[model samples]
Target: MLKIQEIRELIKLIDKSSINEFKYENDGAKIVLKKNGSGESQLAESHAQPAAVQSVPALQPQASVPVVQQQDAMPAAEQKEKVQDETLHKIVSPMVGTFYSASAPDQPAYVKAGDKVSKDSIVCIIEAMKLFNEIESEVNGEIVEVLAENGQLVEYGQPLFLVKSE
Candidate 1:
């Protein structure tokens, strides 16, 4: 998929060029250019045909299977995952900027393993362009892990903090 910035660049290039038609592929997107007889540039539109899909076989239950056994298996899986939850932590981002956990100037780190944090604690700062957006923790517990590294771009729902919620 082409980024929003790349699409803007394509539009600019089409306007400046006197070529009637242009087609190029960049960043996984097919760009097409078409022009009128008078050399008027037109917006590029990519056309793609859907591929054929193969049939998939659906799983069926055997007549000999017991409903009680199936029910027991479902609960066992859930129990395993829930038990491991304590050893795991969730990382969440704070803002709409790049995420960086480490500090500059040859510093060690703002956080690490076995770190305790409160719900309102500042886990990390997200830098958007030149501004710094502080990310805060939503849970109070011990820091189990870090989800994103320093200077990593993060989306709104991107994980940035990991804590072992008590």
Candidate 2:
């Protein structure tokens, strides 16, 4: 298995490059990252037996990765709506994790619709591998919508919130 830092580096490199897909396999472990037409990327990892297995090893369950295909164009009405909302910016997840609207169950949400935020504001939290990560708003804007529900599973690059720029 790749270390967390290595995985982070790989994600950064892939996001900055023109490549839309990347795959790596070693010692029964595999990692795949693919980008959709909208430039959002999804990550998947699994362990597989070697092609030329000489002996049967302990069987382990495989991780399932959902495949989603997007159409090239939206319906006319949707397209018109999208055009009108072109100024909205999406705050996407930096990794696959469980989305949390607040730090704790009793705590209030970090931000809500209509809340004004600056470029460095914390918008939400994403828990991955038992670590709680604070997600920042990279753009100065007013929160328009919260896309991910509390405790929902979010994929890498999945949109968590939409903001209208100031």
9-71, model 2: which lDDT tens digit per residue? 786798799999899898888777776665655566666755543221111122355446553
- TM-score attained by model 2: 0.68
Lowest lDDT block of 10, candidate 1: 53-62
List the global CA lDDT of all models.
0.58, 0.78
Mark the 10 consecutive residues where model 2 has the least summed lDDT.
54-63
* Candidate 2, superposed: residue stretches over 4 Å from native: 14-23, 32-44, 49-73
Clashing pairs in 2: none
lDDT agreement of model 1 with the native: 0.58
- Model 2 has an lDDT value of 0.78
